[model samples]
Target: MNPLNPLTPQDAPTPAPGVYVPGYARAKLGMIAAGLLLMGLGFSQFAEPLRLLLFGERARAEAVRVVKTKEGLPDQVLESDRQVTAALEPRDRSYTFWNEFRFADGQGSSFEVRAPVGSQLKPLYPLIDEEGLPTTDLVVYDRAHPERSAFPMIVSTWFAPGMLFVIGTLCAFIGSFLFYWAKKPIELPRLPPTAPATSTEKD
Candidate 1:
């Protein structure tokens, strides 16, 4: 008996119950781990260089394995071996005690911070700084980050927006595995053919 309320050919399962269980379980765990690592990446984005340090150390190897572009480009775009120092933009954009309060004059009276916003964040590939600045050996690019301390992980590759597709692929693989895992089937013994249907004499 078909269990689906609206039956379809695509909904039908394979002849054998062994169609897809084990692989799904393995990939599911990997997908979950990937998701956790992905979340950790967003956390790193907001927290300033923390995500870089963490993801760089943890998923760096796996990340490098994934292609970043249509022609299989790497995330680490290198312009040169130059190192430059740049200050962070003080990313405490929050409702602190003063920020959360409203002034009687109806004007926002939060603590004003003096931080330099860079004109351009170009040519920096591997290590994006605490201020999301990149590290490349370009002189014009270094005017903002003149301090020459390089974040080593910047050159390690696998740090970019496109890596999300890699994560999606992992999810698809996980889904394929699960599709077979939940499948079940029934078996029956074969009935022997009746012997020639002989007629009885007594009527």
Candidate 2:
């Protein structure tokens, strides 16, 4: 053993390359796929709201009446006296209300449309006027399909989509980070430098 070089050939063997873990790779791919699917689902939920915002026509429609019904039950007219009690009812009770509106298109063609979104608790807008008659409210309808109309309310238009968008965005970000980390090149431990061999000669 050479005193000048403490490290021997046995001590400096090259490090073996990192081995691929099938389970880890599969997990990474699954995360990425799930994130992408969530992003697509969330984005697709915005289609109707975006369509109404961009190409919809705004008009005043008469609040003809409110229909109150329970799931799997016949619809009944929501009376003004019962409005407050109904509104205060718990959401788990499954009672819901839909507002019916009557409006005319630019061509003077009459159309009656129901609100696309139903309220589980209370009516979205007031239907009665000071004189105790049905009143007019703002509605946004697709010009191409007036039958598809909705009240211009935030909850009906954007609340659910916005929540989904946020959740999807967060998931996509986490998934992307995990994927990048999983695909990063594995670094092998480096061997220490070996000293040059020296020879001694005798005369």
Candidate 3:
């Protein structure tokens, strides 16, 4: 018999790792990664339409798409609503805009962009819906110079705080659960025994 073996006659069961073990850390990491992915997606949607103006003439020459009518004619080619964002230098908050395009047989509908909350939102605009469309600016220059028709523009926008808040709440909830499972249970308090009625010495 091995002296090191504590069990006399039977095999002892092995104890599993606690909830706070490395396994839990790995699980939390996975959750964090997923959270980051969601956060990234939200941010990606916001970083579009960075002003092409920043690019030099050589880069601008490389600009692929020609800026046609900003607002497409009503009842024309229907376009899905697109989102764009900008987080410029020195600014704590970011900006988000919803833009869309549509046109019809001959007449075209104006493309509109909206910002839910931003300093540039002088006249409130709503996101385009299936029912109808909104107004937009369409600059027309010389007919021969279609290239000049394309213009660099910015959509009204505001900071994206909702995603950060949601991510924070999820992390806190998961972290708390892991911590709770790893904690040891508390011991119950002892109660005082009731004193039995006995004859007093004087009595």
For model 2, residues 85-143, the per-residue Cα lDDT tens digits are: 55445656588777778999877888998877777767665678778777787777788
Candidate 3, run of 10 with poorest lDDT: 58-67
Residue range 27-74, candidate 1, lDDT tens digits: 455666666566556444334333333432211110011111112433
TM-score of 1: 0.23
Q: After superposition, how far is residue 95 of candidate 2 from its true place, in Å?
A: 1.0
Worst 10 residues of 1 by lDDT: 95-104
How close is each model in CA RMSD to the real structure? 18.8, 10.6, 15.7
* Number of the predicted model whose TM-score against the real structure is largest: 2
Candidate 2: deviation at residue 23, Å? Answer: 8.2
> Worst 10-residue stretch by lDDT in candidate 2?
14-23
Q: How many backbone clashes does candidate 2 have?
A: 0
Pairs of residues clashing in candidate 2:
none
Displacement of the residue 52 alpha carbon in candidate 3, Å = 8.5
Off by over 4 Å in 2: 1-23, 79-92, 129-136, 185-203
All candidates: TM-score:
0.23, 0.67, 0.27
